[model samples]
Every structure is written in structure tokens, then in C-alpha cells.
Target: MSKVILITGTSTGFGKLMAITLANAGHNVIAGMRGVTAKNAEAAKELGALPNIEVAELDITSDNSVNEAISKTLTKYGKIDVLVNNAAVSGFGLLEAYSLDQIRNMFEVNFYGVLRTYNAVLPSMRANKNGLIINITSGASGHTLPFMIPYLASKFGVESITEGLQDELSQFGIENVSIQPGVYPTEMNNGSKSGIHADKPAIIDEYGDTATQQFNALGSALFSKMAEFKMDPQTIADGVLALVNMPKGERPLRYPLDAVAQGTDQEFIDARATIKAKWLAKYSN
Candidate 1:
């Protein structure tokens, strides 16, 4: 069935692809992004021309923007059957090297952005007793990485939200899923898009050549593996579409779309689920 779907960060990367893909599949798409009239004017115009897509300016970090965008969507569409929280900012730096404000800024978009969308959308979703929220998390969200600590931490927070909300909203038939995408050569990772990287030059200088070398080596290896695995951003878009079309109660809580992980991501997800089930059983008893 055709449903109304609102996706954030639709100016580029996975969100854009998902918007296009879902709209092509006959769903009404509200393509949400910042700078709709400024930096992303072309993207907004291009997507807006599509019959199924309505371009909306939405900066997820702002409660007013999120609320307004969702309000308009609900008012027009009558209901949003699915929300794809694909909007997020990525950061890379040593934990100590990042200033509190920088870290907070990253979280404002990556973590709190998800919260804002949920708060805006959940009331209508609950009233309808049917909705699905798919969050685009990271491959390292299940664990952690060195330079990308802050970024992964934010994604991890979303993972936690997806899990907790799965049960919390179960009674209302609202389903939640986090899509853990591996290294895809999107604008975010390919240097076309800017990220909230480490700002403390003095602290970075203190870490010196050794730290630089390690960060460089890690980047090289990740890029190499990404190329080797042929990680396509479209895979994530297709995954979101599949989840949307899935039977209401049959969707998995965590969907990992990392070919580079070579099933290790699935293994980690399975192991974590098993451990969580046992832990919950103990608490219940």
C-alpha cells in the first residue's frame, strides 16, 4: 500500500536515495533537509519536482523546525505511516581532544535530532496505532572505534532508543528499527560533505605524528575495505524500503546492512540479542 513517509537529511546520501527509492515505489515522500532555499536549493527543487515528493526545510536539531515540518506533513498527508530518521552528523576525533561544546553539537544533531522527530511524530502515530521508525545508525554503533568515538556514541544512543522504544511502543503497534550501515562512499564519508571533526588544534598537536599516523592508517584501511566490499549506499535505501513493505509484526529490531562486516555484524546482533533476552528473563524472574 502507498503510505506517507518523511525522511530527514534528504539533501544527500542515504536519506536522498531512500526518498527517491520510496517515492519511486509509489509512496508519498516528504523529503526533509536543512538549507532547502540556500545550499540545497537544487536538491530541494529536483526532489520537489517528483510527483510523490514534497520538499520540506527541516533542521532536525531545532524543535520548532522538526515540529513544524512534521505538523505540515501530518496536516497534508493526514498521517505519516513511517518516519526514516536518516538525518545525522558525523564527527571524528580523540575523546579528550573534543571540546564539550563540539561534542554537544554533534549530539544535538545525531542523538537529540532523533528524539525531536520521535516527539513530533509519536502522538499521531500512537493515535493511529500504526507506524514504523527506521534510524540510520553506524556499523560501529554496536561497538566502537577510535577516531570516530563521538560519532559512534551518538549512533549508539539511537540504537538504544530503537531497542527501548520497540517495547515501549509495542502496545500501540509502533515498530522501531535501526539500520547499521557499513562504510558506504557517500558524500558524508567521501570529503564532499563536511563533518564535525576535532576542533582542538592544540590538543591534536599534542597527540602529534603518532596519532596522525594511526588515524591516517585507519582511514586508509577502511576506505580500502569499502572499495573491496563495493559498499553501495543504495543498499541502505533498499533495506529501508524492504522494512517498510515488511509485515507489520515481522520486522527485526536491528537491521545491519554491512557487507564489509561479512556477517560478523549479524553475529554481533544475534549475540547481543541472546544476551539481552537472558538478562531480561533474569530481571523478570
Candidate 2:
């Protein structure tokens, strides 16, 4: 069955790989990104040329863009079978050094952006009583690391939301899962390299170069390892495909497609299942 799928953040990284792979697998895909006519025009053109793919303009932060994109998707495809919330931005270095606005903006995209898409698509999903939501989170969701506090916190927030949805939507047969990927050499690493929100002059004098210098050392080592063993984006694309093809109610809530052994997301998934079973029993009527 060729289902209609809408994916955000298709301009690069996991989103782009998943969009292309799913469409190639005979699914109807709507690839949504921020700059359809501008920065990502080439990507849009390429994906748009695919037989089952349509490129759409969607800035997940703006409710208007979110609504319009969903509306257009629904009008064309009747209903969306899956919504992949993959649009996310990351920042590194000291959490204290970055301004509040910088952290908030990252949160807007990583956390609230998913919320917008969830709000836009869940109505249709619940009405249909069958749909899927795959949030592309990170290994940072389950584990913490230095210098990446804000980015990891945002992922943690997304992780929490996805977990709640898993329990909340189970009765409706709408699956909500998070893909906690390990380090991959996607454009996201490029963003990480640029170190968005890495420095804050407000507190730099107080802390001096102590924290940032340590972060720089960590980055160098991590980048070297990434060059040696970075996971392919296809690892996640395949995971998404499997989750889509999985029978309803049989899919796990978290799929950690990680090459590195950072957080052991699979072990965490098992632990969560045990916890959910025991914990939710208390609330059962």
C-alpha cells in the first residue's frame, strides 16, 4: 500500500534521506522544508522530480506555514498516513554563555516545532484513527554530554513528548515513535561544527576561556572519530521504513539507530517498557 507521508526538514540530513528513500519505496511523499524557493531550491527540484514526491514549503515554527502545508497535503492526498517531525536545530558550547533568546529559538524549532506539526496532523490522524508520527530525536535524548546542554535539553523535551504520545495515542491506533540516532556525518554536524550559540559575551569574562577551550578539545576528538566511524543517514532511513511497514501496535516506541555506543538507546527502550508496564498498572481502572 502506498501511503501518503509528510516529512519536515527535507532540505538536509535525516529528513532528506528518509524522504527520498520512502518515495523510492513506492510511497507518496511530501517533502517539507523552510526554503523551497531559495536556499534549498536545488534539493526541492531534485526531490520534486521524483515520481511519488512533492516538495512543499513548511516552516515548522510558524503556525500559518504549518497549517498551510497540512492543508495542501490533505487536499492533494486526502489524508496523511504519517507525519515525520524531523526539522531540528542544534547548539553547542556553554549553556550559560549563550543568551536566553538563542536557547529559546533552538527550543522553538526542536520542541515547539514538533508540537506545531503534531497539532496540525494529529486531528487528521485521530479522525482517521490510524497514523504514525516519527520524531527524529538524538542519542542526546537519553544521555547528557558537556557543551551540548541546550541542544540535548531540546531533544530531551522532544523525547518526553513522544513518550507521552505513545501512551496517549495507543488506544487510537496512532503510533508515535522517536528515532534516537547516533552521531552521523550529515549537514547537522556541519551546523554543530559552526557551533551555533557557542559563545556569550555576557558571561565570557566571568568564565574566561575555560569552558569553551574544553569544548574545543572535545569537538576535535569527536570530529576525528566521526570521520572514522560516523553512521550513515541511511541507517535511520531504513529504520523509518521498517517502522512504517510494521503492523500496528507491534512497533516499539523508540528505535535507536546508532553506530556508536553512546547511550544504549535499545537498553533504555527495554527499560522503558518495563517501567511503563509497572507504572501504568497503578492507573488502570
Candidate 3:
């Protein structure tokens, strides 16, 4: 059962680890990222050198790039058995402090990027009557938080997509799941990777030291929890593998993988599910 898989944002973090993990398990993996021959050439070369992994030039932000990469994969492999929508950008700022354009830019990568990949891959998946899509969302996707509003909002959008599409595509045997990963010490959170942060210096200044202090405190607490829980990015990669290897109809709609949540994430997920089921029942009746 060596299924063909395509994963976006393979240049780093969970996506990169998933590529290696899945490929090592004998799955055919297309590691998709932007600037394959330019900015990401080294990563592309390194991953391409690995067995069962092929690095493809795929910029999720562009429809053309997404379509081309998916088309090539389908043309070569005939069908993509699974797609991991792991590509996303993170941002942090007060909601009012962020410019509309900055928010849109973050959405371009985090929200629209998922849509691009879905539109590109769904047809072939539907035609084949079988497929799985795993979206890497956030632990806060069910709710909201200060500072990381835009970033979490975008992830929440994906969570919505995953839930709705699960039923919509069920008839065709297609499955969708969202992985809500809490803070892990990946490059994305560790300062090595640049994030779309608040750029309105004037607005930030207006908010003054209070906002800055709160933001700093939140960051410190999150980092501390990450260390205390030993939250490894590999856990996400392993979770993806587990989902992929699961029986076709046995996967849950939402999989929360944050050890730091100490079961509270699961509690939230279950509570939400209960409420949603009740809502659906009322509508059906």
C-alpha cells in the first residue's frame, strides 16, 4: 500500500519531517514548495536526493503553480491518494494594529493557499472515488486569541473547510481531517523563520507598553510550556503517518496533537462535536 502523496511547505518544519517520515515508510511523496530552483534549491536538492521523494516547484499562493504541480503529479502517478495541506504563514499582532493588506497577505498564504490546493486536487480525487486531505491547522483554531488573530483566523478557516468537506466528499469516499497542533519549537516559532508580524508602528505605539508586555508574557509562557511538554514537531509528522495508515473510514474529523493541552484540546474537540451534532440533528428534524 504505497500510496502517492503530495505535501506542501516541504522546505521546513512539519512538512519536511512528514515527507521524510512518509517516504521512509515507502510512500511516494511529492515535496511541494516555492522557488524550487532558486530560494529553496538546497532544500529541493536535499529532499530530491532522498528515495521516494520528489521535489516540485509549487507556490500555493498561485493558482497556476498549484495546478501545474498537481497536474504533473496526477499525470505521472495517475492519482494523488493523499494531500497534506501543511503550507501556511504565521502572523502576530493586535487585530486593529494590522493593516488590511497585511491581513490579506497572510490569508493569501494560509487561507487561499489551502483553497488552491483543494481545487487543484479534488477533481482527480473525486474521479478516483478515494482520497484523504490533512490540513495542519492550529490548536486555537476552535476559538480566538490575542496577538495571533489573523494567523489563527486563517487556520480556523481551514478547520471549517475540513469539516464541511468531510460530509460533502463522503459519497465519493474522500476524507478530510484537520490537525490542530499547539505551539512547537519549529523554525516558525523559534525566530529562524520570519513571520508576518504587525507592521503598524504608529498603532502599536498607541497601544503602548501594556500591549507589548502582554505579548511578551504570552510568548514566554508558550515557550515555557513547549519546553515543559517537550513538544516535538515529529509528533505531527507521526500523526500524519498514522492517519494515512488508518482504515479508510476510521479517521476522525479533527485530530488534536498538543501535549501541552493536557487533554483540554480533546475536551474542546469533543464538546464542540457534541454541540455540532445536536445542531445538525435539530436542522434535520
Candidate 4:
């Protein structure tokens, strides 16, 4: 069935690919992003030119923009069958390197952004009693590694939010699932917002050359893994398509796009399932 879908962060990477792919599959996709009239102008125009893709301004951090975007979509299409929270910003640095403000901003986009979108869509979905929410998380969601403390912390919050919604929204027939894609060659890896290190050189100096070298080495290894696996963004789009095609009430709560089968997310999920089953068996009965 053809459905109207709203996807955040459609300006680039998997969000952009998923927007095109879903639209190509006959779904009406509302691609939401910041800077549609500025930095992302070309992307917005290109996606808007597509047959079923509508580009709109949605800065997840802004409540007004989020409400307006949802209103526009609901008004035009009358319904949004799916809400894909794929928009995220990544910052890389040691936990102490980034300022609280920087960490807060990252959370605004990576964690609270999902919240804003969820709040906007929840009422309508409840009224209709049917909806799907696909949160684009990361393999680093439940845990963290070197140099991405802020990003991973935000992801952990998102993961918790998604999981909570997965259980809570079941009564409303709204399925909430998360896509935890492994490290892939995305623009976010370009270190655009590397973080508060350069500004806090004194702290780095305090940490000593050895700690700095170790952090650099860990980052190098992480990037090497990305180069080695080279996962494609299309795979994530296909994952989203799978959820769309899934029979209602039968979709899995989490999907891991671990291209190389590294088992970080899958292992965590397996352990989680065992624990959840035990808890349900003990507490529910």
C-alpha cells in the first residue's frame, strides 16, 4: 500500500538514500531537514524534484519547526504512516574534551530530536491506531568506544527512548524499531565537528602525550574498520523497506545492519532477549 512517510535528516547519507528509495517504491516521503533554504538548498531542490518526495524544513531541535513540519505533512497527506527519525549530528572527542554546551547540542539533535518528532506524531497515530517509527541509531548505541563519547552517549539515550516506546506504544499499535547500522563511509565520519580538544589544548596537555596518542590510535583503528567493511547506505534503506513490508504487529523491535557481523549489537541484543524473556516470565506470570 502506498503510504505517506516522514523522514528526518534527509539532507544526506542514509536518510537521503531512504527518502529516494521509499519514494521510488511508491510511498509519499516527506524529507525533513535543516537549512533547506540555505546550506542544503541543492539537496532540498533535488529531492523535491522527485515524483513522490516532498522536501521541507525540520530542525529537530526546534519545537516550532517540528510541529509545523508535522502539521504540513498531516494537512497535505492527511496521514503519516511512518516516521523515520534518521536525522543525527555526531561529535567526536573524549568525554572531558567537549563542553557541556556542545554535548547538550549534540543531544538536542541526536536524542531530543527523536523526542520532538515522537511527540508530534503520537497523537495522530493514537487516533488512527496505526503507525511505525524507525529510529536510526548506531552500533555504538548501548556501549561506547574511544573518541566518540558525546555521540555514543546521545545514541544510548536514543536507544533507551526507542526501547521504551517499543513497549509503551504497543497498545496504540504503533511499532517503534531501531536500525543500528555499523560504521559506514558517511560524511559524518569526516570529523567535521571533531570537538572541544583544540579549544581545550591545556586539558589535552594535562592528559599527557600518551593518552592523546592512544586516542588517536583508537580513532585510526575505528576508521580502518570502516574502510575494511565499507558498508553501503542502501542496505539501511532496504532494512527500512523490510519494516514497511512487514505484516503489522510482527516486526522486530530492533534491526542491526552490522555489515561484517562484528556482533557488537547482535550480541547485546541476544543477551537482552534472554534477560527480557526471563523477566517477563517471572514478572508477568
The most accurate candidate by lDDT is 3
Clashes of each: 0, 0, 0, 0
After superposition, candidate 4 runs with Cα above 4 Å error: 192-199, 280-285
Model 3, 76-172: lDDT tens per residue?
9999999999998888889988999999999999999999999999999999999999999999999998999999989999999999999899999
What is the C-alpha local distance difference test score of candidate 3? 0.95
- List model 4 lDDT by residue over 187-244, tens digit each: 7766553332324556667888888799889878777877788877789999998899
Better of 1 and 2 by lDDT: 1
| Ten-residue region with minimum lDDT total, candidate 2 | 190-199
The predictions' CA RMSDs to the true structure, in order, are: 0.7, 2.2, 0.7, 1.9
Q: Where does model 3 exceed 4 Å of error?
A: none
Q: Candidate 4, TM-score vs. the true structure?
A: 0.94
- Model 2, residue pairs in steric clash: none
* Each prediction's TM-score versus the true structure: 0.99, 0.92, 0.99, 0.94
Better of 2 and 3 by lDDT: 3
Off by over 4 Å in 1: none
By summed lDDT, which 10 consecutive residues of candidate 1 come out lowest? Answer: 87-96
Can you write out model 1's per-residue Cα lDDT over 169-237, one digit (the tens) per residue? 999999999999999999999988999988989999999999999999999999999999988899999
The lDDT per prediction is 0.95, 0.86, 0.95, 0.86
Displacement of residue 21 (Cα, Å) in model 1 is 0.4
